[model samples]
Target: MSRRLFSCFGKASSNPNHDDKATTTADLTTEEQRRCGPVVVELFSSQGCATSSEAELLFSRLGRGDFKLDVPLILLAYHVDYWDYMGWKDPFGSSQWTVRQKAYVEALNLDTMFTPQIVVQGRAQCMGNETEEILSCVASAPRVPAPTFQATFQKPTPESLQVSFTGALRTKVDQEGVSVMVALYECGLVTNCPNGVNKDKVLANDYVVRRLEKICSVKDISAKKTLSGTVNFPLWESFNPAKCGIAVFVENSSRQIFGSQNFQLPDNI
Candidate 1:
């Protein structure tokens, strides 16, 4: 929305801080949740990167709709493990996310992957801190058709959280080529860097991905078709449903996201 954007980090970086996780202000109206989400913003970040904090801060604004953009976004931050060797390890970093970022690198023909980068709707890519470019991507990105979802939660054991969801796809896509991705992301997180480029800094992260799973392979029937599946999220010592939410999206083998929606767990089910 402004030409005031900055250049991207080309395999090089700097440092900054982060944003608060989901807040009471992030809650949307029923109609907004019911409609097909406008975009899916995937942030590939790390606590080890100096510039990642700026990106995280920007994501927090987008997540909170601070700019009041018309686009509805489902945000997920994947803290990658590549930077751990620098000094400090991101408590949330994982090789799985590194692999995911690598796949995006290949799909988008990027020379290399870096922290504070974002993929919009699995179709557009940009530096995470490039606020203006991000907004541009959101305004022009292709979106998925509207979807419907009903979710239920069950605590079978203290260590496990079972989440079952039933939903209907409003559009058709190849069943074998795509799958539904369910991510359990948490907010209200704060970490103090012990070392690394971000040493001695306080970082606040929002929408940090805690668990990701392929709930089911997608199939589009000619008629109104319903799909249901369950994802058992391993409960951590500090797991709290209030600050966590489930984001479901359809992605093909090519890493193109078709549509996505986020749901807050109901108090009863």
Candidate 2:
């Protein structure tokens, strides 16, 4: 799919269900207990980059709920295709993801693009291996608005799953140009590399993005202004429902993230 955002610069581009369940807070981490607002961490990485392993592991820990932080953390791992030219081609790599990263490069005005890069809440970018810097960015991220965000999941048939998200814009940005996006992410993935810089290494990954869908664009939004959309996904034979989840976030024309929310898929279904 093309990685274009309708209201901004470009255009871009599920489901199986045996169960129907309206998600609840219990299906998600307890955000009410968190001391800070939601923080979205995007990792642009490649299996061919040796340094990406460390960052991937760190993201795995966060996804596993090992962090002691007081904020809600939403992690996403976007495997870029740039490194595939190496001996080993990353099975998860996508040129669309590479385009997404390049868009960020222009948005953030960075010196150059590199593997194992981390963008925190779309406000700061740092070397993915810089653990201390990553933590500081999360610690200082702006607080998102309260429980105004909502996500609902349902399986109307055995072959499809439908997800609907609703949330309000808690903050405003310049030009009043903003867009909402919903992403389906999978966790607890492992890949064994036979060739490339990471040859012979078994890498564990989480919050690995499987798909990203744009919801809508807002020319202007005031506090509590609602943004909502529903997306349908086909259930693939390779999908492990228990290891999946959803993430939703708002970004401005400049690609700065305003806030985000996430929820885990219930095992009962």
Candidate 3:
């Protein structure tokens, strides 16, 4: 059976109760600071999918700098390749992302995978286009242990970019496993679809993931081991440094994200 996409619309706003100052102020305790960690939202979508355009717009608005949210919001749009053969091909679609979505389906134990599906903090799923449902999930999301995460990017050569990250779990947990994942995303991406269900429509996408790379994995949580790695950037010919950034996150065996951070690329790079 073909999967159906859900839709809804409303004015965008941030969580008011979130304490952004907790992260920067010395007055707050460690627990208070961890409460300020950003919520990670992953949207599995495709340009060729009939209902994905609306979800793309919703996510774009949420990722905007001027949205004025109290808590940090980290959004990633992963385009899947499964729909490309249906007349119009999605330029950003990737088979790797398709596999990623499938992995989520298995983790969530869902019978089927569909476009315009939003996964919050890698722990909850909702209809991508429904602002209320998405926000509700974000608000009720369980607070996971925060980890110290840092990332840096530089253009080593005209044809290549280099990225490095360092992280250490800050709190104790009894997880069976953990893995660090890094994603490269670009904003202000525009595409004009001449065919398919969205024929003749222009779509704007934000935080659209260009590549996702795994950094490392951990088996023992009791030990405080620092995780670090340097990787060559997955260069996209159409990438604009002004609209690109990186997100680093740590996920456990059950696919629950414990911590995450987002960094925008330097303008000159």
What are the lDDT scores of the predictions, listed in order? 0.77, 0.71, 0.74
By TM-score, is 1 or 3 better? 1
For residues 10-46, what per-residue lDDT tens digits would candidate 2 score against the true structure?
Answer: 1111001111211112134345435334778899888
lDDT of 1 by residue, 61-114 (tens): 898888887768899999988777778889999989988988887777666677
> How many pairs collide in each candidate, listed in order?
3, 12, 0
Rank order (by lDDT, best first):
1, 3, 2
Q: Which is superior by lDDT, 2 or 3?
A: 3
TM-score of decoy 3 = 0.83
C-alpha-based local distance difference test score of model 3? 0.74
* Residue range with the least summed lDDT across 10 consecutive positions in model 1: 14-23
Model 2 segments more than 4 A misplaced: 1-36, 65-67, 156-159, 172-175
* Candidate 3 C-alpha error for residue 224, in Å: 4.6
What overall lDDT, based on C-alpha atoms, would model 2 receive against the true structure?
0.71
Q: Residue 238 CA error for candidate 2 (Å)?
A: 1.7
Model 2, position 268, has a per-residue lDDT of: 53
